[model samples]
Target: MSRAQPPIAVLVALSAVGPLALNMFVPSMPGLAATFAADYGTVQLTLSLYLIGLAVSQLAYGPLSDRFGRRPLMLAGIGLFLVGTLIALLAQSIGMLIVGRLVQAIGGCAGLVLSRAAVRDLFDRERSASVIATITMVMVVAPMVAPLIGGYLDQWFGWRANFWLVGAFAVVVLGFAVPLLHETNHYRQPLPGLSGMIGSYAILLRSPVYRAHIALIGFASGAFFAFLGAAPFVVIDLMGHPPSDYGRWFALGAAGYMAGNFASSRLAVRVGLCRLIQAGMGFMAAGAALMLTLALAGQMTLLALFGPMAMIAIGNGLVLPSGNAGALSVDRRRAGAASGLSGFMQMGLGAGISTLAGHLVVDSALPLAAIMAVSVAISLLAFHALRRANRQARELAARTRPALPKAA
Candidate 1:
């Protein structure tokens, strides 16, 4: 690690790009629809396509980063992201804008996967969790402010200006990344062939611990993804709030998330990541259950919905960093692949949940609350499985310790 560019800095820089990609243009969706003379659903395809591109490309980026080194792959991906941003800025049609989003997502996947890999590269399980939590605290600011800024830009300038702003941001990040980001995968040797790469992934996928952690992250993230996908419909559409009001509501939820991330950073070492994960899942389950109850009772106000939603967001902030760190900790030498696979599962599951929830949008809040509750329940199941696996491993290790040498 370079003294000038620490792992934490790299994680921050990389993770920051994700929120920029996802949230910076969100407030412009309505403007974009009018600009292209398209329906809202057609315009929303920009989000859907970006997510789909991000999900599918992680499988490719992980293996490539594993084969070729983290720094090079990350730089290349950012370069692509920059190009995509420029394309979107110059786009004159809805189809062109969608294409740009897909391209941007393909590039953005590098940041999402490689940043986690870099953390696993530099730190052990506990330390990695702390680092991720800290970085997440900083990264959450993008969502908090991006939409606010985007709304102002759309109001003052035009929807195309949002893409121009993103392009400018990407240019700045690319400049910073070129010199600051160092290669972290010191133990990664390039595999000889496709068979070798496939064999390596097969070996990693065999680990019960890794799968358990990945599942925990996937479902936990699904809760937030469902909220992200459905919040516009439930809040701005059904609840009759202005679209600009999204920034305020999202910022409150994001504040809770950032607070949880900060708390996890401080407590993961003392309480243990496993314990934190279990506790976080419990909080999420309880929050989702509350939201579901309110929705079912026909008394779900916006505050009622957003209050538990913030709690669920906070729980996710706690669970995600720990689960991701745990998954990557299972195989340090294969950190890139592990990070990639875990990112694949998390984003893949999030995309599915978000898409399903988007389609289930109705006049009532039931569908959204139902999806969130199910996601939390699934995450709790994963946490339980991880706990049992950890116990079994401890028992097996004790059994194999030669009966403590009979010294006692």
Candidate 2:
């Protein structure tokens, strides 16, 4: 790490681009549809397509960072993101909006992947997890209140102003990142060619420990994405609340997420990663169960829906930082690649879950609750399997350790 390195707040700001972009724009979707004369599904494509672009681009940026160092590539990413944001700000049609958003996703992904990699680059695994937890807790505030700000922005300045805000934030981050960002990749490997990059991915895919962490995060995050996809329609469309109201409901859930991150930051090293993840899964299961019970009992009101969601958010905060560190731990030499791959998995699964949730087209909250429940339950199963695999690997390594022979 550089002596004059930037604070973790900078990293938090950088990593927050994805969610901030996503959440801030959500409140404006109805307005966007009205502006471009498009349908809800068409407008929603901006989010889904952006996530797809983000997933694919991060896969490449990780290795590129490993080869070129984090600073230059990150700056390039910020530049591209601004370009896309400008394009969207000036867009006159839905097609143009989606095109700009796709480009923007590819650009914004740089910060999201690199920020996590930067933490791993600078700190030990345990401390990295704690720092990540703290960063996430703070960064989450972006998504937490973004819709509120964005709602007012839409009402006052029009939807294009949301992109303007995104651009402004990126510019500020770039200013700081240039002056204070440090290079953490001490061992510079030559940038891999196509085949070499594939080989690197192959190696990560072969690690059971790495894959387990990926699976756990993928499903845990999927549940949240499913909610993000469905909530606008549920709250604004079905329940007939204004877009501004969704922001208030979302904050309650975000508070839960923030609480969990606080706990993870405080207890990650002492409680250990695996235990924290397990406890998080337990929280998820409990929340999902509560949601399911309410839905089945015909109590599928707004409180019934989002209240339980807060609990799941809490679990995600606990599991995600620990999971990211665990995945990177399995391949410290390739922390960039691991972080990218895991992020891709998280977003890719999120995209799929959200897409499905959209297509479900439910008149009630029961369907959404059911999907979230199932998703979290599956995440729990993945964690247990990972736990067992880790235990076996540890025992095998212990047995294979070289005997001390006779004391010299």
Candidate 3:
């Protein structure tokens, strides 16, 4: 086996790229709009398009990594990301900027998908979950500080500086990847044709264990994306916080998520993956329910909003690592397909929820809270279904196993 190169550090570096790529440009959104002379709605398309690119491209990256190997794909993706950053930096129009963002996303999705696959490559469920949690604990800082850093950059050197910074970051990651990262997909064999790829995915989809875990993670992720899409508008536009204050609020929620990840890392080994996920879903549900109630009562102040929001963030952090690790644990031989399918479902659901929440955003916090409640409730249901499936699997295995000899 290739030496596992400190999974926690690898994950931290990989996870950092995703949020940094997205959030570093968020503070510059208004400025970008003004520069392009576009409406706010049009400018928001940059974010939407990035998510679209990320979701769609992840499917290709996962299987390709499986077919070819992880290190080469990762290195090439980083190169592509750097190129995209350069394009964004030099873009003179909104359309060009959007194109660059899309390209960046295509490359960024590699880091996300492969990181999970790599974890699954090296570890089992509980250990993988712990590794993911530790990574999340460190990586959560990206979102917390990205906007703050972006804001300063926007104020100082204009929006193009953000892209330049991203380019530099990409180079740094590439440097690390060259020496530290190694191919971990020992089971992966070269596919001879399209039919082989299709068969791989089909086999993964047919597995009940994989489906349950993927669904749980997908819905749980949707809840967080719903919050992310709606929170800025609710906080800044409805709640009267200045745009500049958004970084602080974003940091608060990220801090809560970081705390949750830390807790999950510590607890997953002892509590078991299923129990930890169950507890997390319960917390998420409770938090969402409380937020919904407060919004309905018209008592959703900043403090009221962030308090329950923190709970949801924490719960999601706890659940995601376990859910992903469980899904990937089902088939070591097809971990890449499992990782691809799970990434597709997770990002697809996230995109849908973000879009729905964005459209449902009204003049109040009610819509956002309601969306979060629904997402969390769905995730809770998914977790229960997974539990039921696990029980059935255990029973089936018991029935199929040979009976022990009467005398030893």
Candidate 4:
């Protein structure tokens, strides 16, 4: 409960753990299935269940942090992540590995939810957007290199090495966090148990502007998820490219996203969140149009697939931070809940869109491009709807708010 806030580097480190752990083990999935003598569907549970855990856990963490504190929940989350890593490292069956991953996700997402909440607690909306963009831009490197490191580890020492490395990382973060991390939620509210927590969420959900922000965040990120799910098959299967090519070209998408985040970090305070969001949706629309146009033209090259995806990534970078900052600003007292709800929607929608893309992208990349296009369209609509609602709300407030007395 110290007055000092955690440093940006510490916040970045805390946030990176979740995404790093999520991607690092991906290269080991096939090998893991072989080792466990399990079917592909069963082995895939490790990932799908992890996503479920991340989404569900955020719902609980937000309200709990509002009631308890951020620092303690953060420490507990990292501790659980380490414990889960240990469990995965020693797993004897696919079932055990699946369970470990779920646990890891539950713990890791605490950082994802609380880090934003902490930023919201400490700063106003625009500044919070700037800080969040900076944090995201820095931490983007974690997922960018995760699969590369995981590939090497899985090739050299087997999949267990991935868990060992992640566990060590968790330990280091926990060590630094124990003394450095302080409670950022200065205004802790009372929750009369489960019903009260639900009521807090209900209050947030009742706000049209809040729901609009969530839609903007969810659908915007869902475009990226759809690409992640289907782009691999379109690149490797339909285009007849090597698996390595997919990884190589994927870097372009990551770089574009990083660039966009860096732009947001620098421009959020100056350009304003709403304008940035509109510009972001513009980029996404252009990207999706390019993707679909190329697919329909019978051009299935790697560039045709990843090039537009890179543009969409850039849009995602712009939208996510601004949308999150807006959502968190809705009700400062329930900032934690707002952050958590937004994260949940983002994850849940991404999961659904990605899964659907996976099933539909069998023959061509057209389906993938279409899905991205639709997702971006929805996000743009949400952004406009939110803007209109804000104007109306302002008008109402201006009419109702009392005028100041003329006496000086």
Using lDDT, give the best candidate's number: 2
**How would you encode candidate 3's per-residue C-alpha lDDT over 1-408 as one tens digit per residue?**
545553457656865776688888876775565689986667776777787778887778777888898777777877888878877888988989988898898888788788878877787878888987887788888887887787678777888888888788878887777878877877776763678777888887787777888888988878778776667667766777655566666677778788888989999999989888887887788889999999999995877787888888888888988888888888787777778778888887887887788678878888888888888888877887898888988999999999988995
* Off by more than 4 A, model 1: 1-7, 401-408
- Candidate 2 C-alpha error for residue 262, in Å: 0.8
Best by TM-score: 2
Estimate, for each residue in 170-227, the C-alpha lDDT of model 4 and write its tens digit.
8998888888887888888885378887888899999999999999999999898788
lDDT values for all models? 0.80, 0.87, 0.80, 0.86
Each prediction's total of clashing residue pairs, residues at least 3 apart in sequence or on different chains, is 0, 0, 0, 0
The RMSD of every model to the true structure, in order and in angstroms, is: 2.3, 1.5, 2.1, 2.2
Using lDDT as the measure, name the better of candidate 2 and candidate 4.
2
Candidate 4 lDDT score at position 2: 47
lDDT, model 1, position 70:
81
User: Could you tell me the TM-score of candidate 3?
Assistant: 0.93
Candidate 3 residue spans exceeding 4 A from truth: 1-7
Expressed as tens digits, the lDDT of each residue in 1-408 for candidate 1 is 553334466668776776687887776775566688997778777777787788778877777777787888888888888888888888889999899988999988898788878777777889989988998888888877887777777777877777787777778878888878887776666763668767767887787787788888999989888887777767766787766676666777788788889989999989999878877887788889999999999865768878898888889888988888888888777777778778878778877887787778778889999999998998888888888887887888898887546665
